[model samples]
Target: MNNLKYSICYISFFFLFMLSMVNFMMMIHFIMNNMVIFLEWEIISLNSTMIIMSILLDWMSLLFMMFVFLISSVVIYYSKSYMSSELNLSRFIILVLLFVSSMMLLIISPNIISILLGWDGLGLVSYLLVIYYQNLKSYNAGMLTALSNRIGDVLILMVVSWMLNYGSWNYIFYLEFMKNDWEMKMISSMIILAAMTKSAQIPFSSWLPAAMAAPTPVSALVHSSTLVTAGVYLLNRFNYLLVDTLPLKILLLMSGLTMFMAGISANYEFDLKKIIALSTLSQLGLMMSILSMGLPDLAFFHLLTHAMFKALLFMCAGVIIHLMSDMQDIRFMGGISIYIPLTSLCMNISNMALCGVPFLAGFYSKDLILEMVSFSNLNLMVFFLYYISTGLTMFYTIRLTMYLMVNDFNLISVYNLYDEDYIMLKSMFILLLMSVVSGSFLSWMVFSYPYMIYLPFNLKMMVIYVSLMGGLLGYLISNMMIHSMNKFIQTYNLSSFLSLMWFMPNLSTYGLSYYFLNFGQNLLKIMDMGWSEIYGGYGMMKIVKKYSIFHGVFEMNNLKIYLFSFILWMFFVLLMLMM
Candidate 1:
């Protein structure tokens, strides 16, 4: 099959899939036997301590490794057709493999020091991938992504330093001890901060949306499954120490606000990738919030399930973008289903799953998460945020669907519609199946006993009510037209603020850099060009010249100069003796 050469990634995909399957079985066996297998190598030894490279082969790490491999394999196979036109196909595939390897490193390591190796690898490789297009937009997005992730890198390095005090860098062993110590609590706070940045929580969120400048497959892999989830995975690991703490409560507040913010922003978004990016942000906030509520298992459950559907969603978007000549504006897309029905089917399924439609992938995790939030002792603000965010998710999904699937096609010609790309379709089908089945599969595997969420009639129906209202509003908003074309001018400022993510991009970029840049400019002016020139270098030359000129005058063969020099020398000698 020479055709298989074009899809070389499929070979790698199958190989990785087999490895993942094996790991899954091993993990299950370990879980069943109540055992953990750790492999350690003492790389270096200090007095009474060792710098160790350790692999943690337990249910959690193995399970996550299996998922990572599963997703990466599917992504690689998907990329074969997606990037078929590119000249440097091998480079792209290599980057994807490197990314997968780094993710694996991150998954298996229990030591903080070893974890940094993987964490920084992800940041570095993702930066490269984001800039793969070599355009100005991609460059800017790459810088933002790298810098945002670099903050986490620095934090993890600090964590490594903190772990040094315990004479061991293995945080897996120290989480319990660290939970009780005040000093260790500070360390835990840093870890949470690192997680927040990686997860794009609150202030660190500007980069995630900006990173949509990359190719869609990179977005699918990095944003959906790997890079962003690293933070949640880290927090999942540290959930024991974080439970019921003030830091975790802060996480809850920020995460809830982030969820609400991204949801609202997605409604205002027009770009296809950006809307999905915001949706991912919203989902991440949901995961972080659930984890903050002391439900790491629920958070992890949502994390894995979200990875499946969101990746599928991005792949579908990629297919649409390719079909429409790289057009990513939903406003420019309408009635796409009439052309590419299969892709549209996958898109709708993913969208419905995103909205937590009952029995879909999102429902099992999202509904459980929301119900758990309701059962917890939460304030009215958080309560409203959780429900409203859920509604906003549906709002954006319905609005997106209206723009892409229901409205009339806006293209100049109908002949441009060609959807039969079996290569792309095949990869999408793989994820489509997972998006439908992964939720039920994970729910069964992760929980031995079913959770009974007992609520009153009104409370039980809260999610459905919000979801229905959200859908209705989305349809109305998408269809509604203004009496005057300039009607939006009245609310332009408010809309712009919400649409621009509260100017967070500006804040993260120019706002953060303004002072340092200003100070540098001032130093260049006053120190380098002004003061140094006047006093240090040029000024010293001027003083020396003046003294030399005076000395020449004094040494000149003139009677007046000789008398003046003698009088000055006599006066100087008398003054020196008096002193």
Candidate 2:
């Protein structure tokens, strides 16, 4: 049965791979001619407005779908090995397929109503995937993932309700016409809110790392590529409506801060998967920041390249985790390249790409984004956040590399670690190849004209200076002898704060809900156990019993005789009056 399932997945991957290639060719043709194709079928009509199913096929959508399909295919192929020992391998594959379908739905739909189907689908399927292991950790992570995304889901539904004012659910048609409309502007704010939750920006950022509780392939496909990117893609589509708005500016500030915070958190992180997950968060912040800066194209460009390398990075982590008997701490993993050289090679390449090494997949997009930010007239804070975030990115990447590849082997001596699995390597190599070439390829294909960055010399070389400093610091700090670390015990609070992501995990998970949980407990005590008992069943019973006792007492006192005599006298008086 497992063999049959694997075969089916492989066939589907091959089919999608060929389809993406053809779609890419068609997208090129459409771009060359500046053409667009739209298809719609009406679902319902209310007065002058019609709710309809709609799909827009343009170069952007085509290219995005191409990447999505490619990544999904690779992730599915990779999962065959990763999930081979699981009893429910088929279930995992189906969930992944469903996730891909939802992502595709989101990509193609321009109609707000139609997009909900896809949006909700992604959320539901992701929750299921997150809890696939059925463990307590997976269960908690799944709930957090679902509820976090539900905020965006509710926002999208609200946006749909607001779209009724424009008499159409097709937001694409009305973006330009409703650009300055107060109602539309309000809708745009809600849309940004929705995007923030989906993209893991700011307060909504905690879910992304917690979601690493999912299987590694799910993390590769969903967290790294498809699911988290949904928000950026939505904002990219809705960029026209966000022009010069306060919400957009707020998005800029929050996303920039997210970029900085996530990078700092990654440097302090020790969990192998989580460190990579935090990097994904940082990249998402970069994309959101760029989108907020009115360059959705650049954001989308980074999105694609990031999808490639980040997915590859996660897959490499999966290989390591699988080999190490699920030990994810980087402290226990050193000189890993000695055994799993190919996996290490892929890891280094992806990490370097993540750091935006020259001519790599991440470089073209990240470099452009930094240069564009430098060129723009921005305040000191946003500017420094960009460069500092970039530097922090390199810092974490180097630190992670040093811990994994160069530090002493801290393993229990009995285990075997080797890159013997060809299946995992094959899946990883596909992404490795793409991560190496995709950035330069995308820069050429997406941007017909290069950005002419104008900045002073020091400002122009800012990324370089910060990156070099970051590299030096990463090496020095990561390589420091362990016993000497006691000197900084006084700064334990500050170090703990950074290590725990400013206590954000606590803030988002327990902090946000601790009051509610405490309130619930109090309510249970006062209402359910106390007041309700007194006021409801017990009180009613008491009243009934008291009346019964009074009646019994009255009967015991022979009150029925007095009651009969009084009634007879009243009846006689009434009879006499009638006569």
Candidate 3:
């Protein structure tokens, strides 16, 4: 069994890597020639309607596919060792392959129906992955993850129905037309709602952290490239429908709030995985908000770059979690850099990339995003959201770093901590190298011309300034102690509200589920068991019983009734003879 799992992992890794390389070459060729290939196969046609499956091969789709394959390859290779002890490792690798296939389908498809095929595939497979542990927490988290993505799936179905007006499911052709038609706005709105749910934007945001219940490899893949980014990719494809629209405005606000919310929530979180999950949420917000601002290129660029470092970060965290016997709280983790220097080095580099530190992978995209935000004619509220969220990102990154690498050891005495797993280290090294260079490499490849940033000195220095302040604040906050009184205790309500994701999890899970379940209970009682049963079934039975009793009484007087009936029969015979 172990040999089979190993063989499966190696086979998957090799296949995915070769595919990634091929896609990369194809992407470069497409970019150089400025070409797009659209292949459509018609399945059925009735009157004005046609059912056609489509695959769109453009630079964007190819590039995204390349990244997806690259990440999946490394993650699968990494998992060979990471999941070596599990009996069901082969099943896990197969599921991961299924997930990658789903993502690829989503990337290449132009038809809404085909997109939904991949979309639903991703949601279902992710739920299965999330619940792989077969425990209560995993079950609950899987439920949340599945249900959240289900909303997006429903919206996509609605989109498919709405697109029927055009007699085609190839929505790519009709995007420009959708922008002008008020009737078509409904489709766009539904699409945005779908994207929001899949991306875990505000109100639907609670499930991202909950999804950490999945194994670390799953988390690294899902959060970094495949699951959460599906929505962003969808919107990126549908960018034309969102230009200068109300849905775009709403998306902008929601995404900005999402960014801010995730940043603040991460600071208050202590669970290492949850913190990283929140950081993914935060970066997703960045991608979405930038996308909403009408720069799909920047959004796509960030999405690609973010994928590199974010996956590396999760891989590093996985190694630590594995070594620590599945302990995730950062409080119990301190100064393990002394023991696992290589892992620590990777983690710190990834963290710096996350903070958008200069010259790193994150910096290339993030700095450009900030500079663009400054360059655009935007309101103070939008401006504040952009910069403050940037700062909060750095703040959490520093705090997390300090806790893991700077503070003294707080775990049980005599814990084995080493970076000796060559498989895991090799996989991480692939991402670490990408995390260092992919940003600049993608920046040059993706953009035809560099964005000219003509900003004042103060405006140009804004990111740096905010980053410094945030880093200092993180250090101070991490070092500070409450000897006299606990401030969190003093401000219990505020702290709880902030720490609990503004009670979103409660609102999403209990608040909505309780009321709906209660309503359903009432419906079941009143409709199914009460009125329906009584009036439809029980009442009819009672009437039949009462009639039967009345007939029984008549039967009791059968002799007299028979004599009367004989006379009546004779009268009826005489009447028939006269006729």
Candidate 4:
């Protein structure tokens, strides 16, 4: 009964999910058997809609749903132990259910408005999950991720406004408008920017790693499975419409570069989950690049394989942390194999798949991308940009496995891993099994033989073995040179790379978070130019504080004048927004 907290969470979620699962299958059956129809078309407002339409489920969307459900169920079960010791476990389950519902709705939403609605709710709900810990840093990270995604929300709103201005909120009508109206294309570019930022490509990448402040299961939810995947899911669904856009080109380049940078960053991280966080960022970048390159099914496939394998990996890391007094640093763990054999096996296998090793989930999906990129219409430079990052996945995976479980004599034995609670082990075992099977299931669905990232992954040599071998050899050589006890090692090649990749962004975040200052040039610029500066008052503000003029102006006998002036300004801004 001491574990009743988690029990209730599991049962409530399982029951709720079972109900939703039935609905999901019912939806599939309905969609397969008959056309879904909406009746009564008489909407006269922006927020309300009425139209008769049917959304056909393509293989891509159906596959994404399969991942969506599979991941949600796995995370919930994993959460039972991942959040076992925390308070509000039951409420966490409720929120998890809400998040799942919102994501599923986002996937199946036939209209942009409904998608936006689901997206908005998902933001709020996911923010709630991130800040659930209420640790000060978690609060900040959650707020930042929510805020960046809000920028995306604003972009989406811009698209919505443009659509409304063009006559109606119809997606079909908007696409038709794109064929002729430059404004429609501009609006779509804005939407693509929103999607890119929301998915954390390059400069928008900070928030996701910061999101590591959440509990492991929440991190798994955000990184491995649900909310963040929303962006890729949308892109995959809308790929047909988006392929010809210039933003698709920009996305391809940016997302590919992001993949490279993120994989490099993963090498610098020492925190167990932070490594996974960086890896997830890199993986998302890869998925986005593939989607941008006109491979929606491949992107969806990557998402599926990534979610399963990454969830298992996170759960394995969660186990180590859970058992070891919350010691999350890689420096603290060596010979974890001696303590947690089950966890070590899970981690090893999952990492192999992640590193693109043979017969694992990450292998097939990633191979498809490699094949596409290798054969893409794009030039060699762009193709190799992503390919380089794919190789880095192998590097970082080896680094993780070597640092955590591959060392010599055991140093730490702080907990009885085998005697660990059933709930945790059971939760993990479920994910491990799925991780083992997802690779094969996905291959069958895609009608391709499983190709490994390593030698002899399958009965038939479907993978490009020479490329895989070349990547491995290059990785081994780099590892040796970087770790060798020579002049270069003394100068510290690996540490320098780590500093540049891992510590620089953290430093920049600190540097850029200072109070804004743009006063002297502002008043003239504000009046002469239309761009208003929201910067701090600087010397003027300091002078006001020193002289007490600030209080006097607002609290003096001239307060009514001030109030009237403020009202007039508010009215002016409103006038501009309307314009």
Candidate that would win on TM-score = 3
RMSD of each: 5.5, 4.1, 3.1, 10.5
TM-score, model 3 to reference: 0.93
* Model 4 ranges off by over 4 Å: 1-4, 16-62, 172-180, 408-415, 446-508, 511-579
* Candidate 2 CA-lDDT value: 0.90
Q: Residue 124, candidate 3: how far off, in angstroms?
A: 1.5
Off by over 4 Å in 1: 1-8, 481-490, 517-579
Worst 10 contiguous positions by lDDT, candidate 3: 481-490
lDDT of each: 0.89, 0.90, 0.92, 0.71
Per-residue alpha-carbon lDDT of model 1 for 1-579, expressed as tens digits? 335545677777888789879988987897778788889999999897799999988887888888787878877788888888877777787898899899888888988887899999999999999999999999988988898898899999998887778888888887776677987888889999999999999999999999998878889988777999999998998887887789899999999999999998998999999999999999999999989989999999999899989999999999999888888888888998888999999999999999999888999999999999999999999999999999999989999999999997875575477777887888899889989998998898788789999999999899999999999878878886433523562278988899988889899888865566678999999999999999997999999999999889867789998888789999999999999
Better of 1 and 3 by lDDT: 3
Candidate 1 vs candidate 2: which has greater TM-score?
Answer: 2
Candidate 3 per-residue lDDT, tens place, 49-114, comes to 988889999999999999999999999999999998999888899899999999988999999999
Candidate 3 Cα outliers beyond 4 Å, as residue runs: 481-490, 529-575
Inter-residue clash pairs, candidate 2 = none
Q: What lDDT tens digits, residue by residue, belong to model 4 across residues 203-228? A: 67888888788788777767887777
Q: Could you tell me which 10 consecutive residues in candidate 4 have the lowest summed lDDT?
A: 453-462
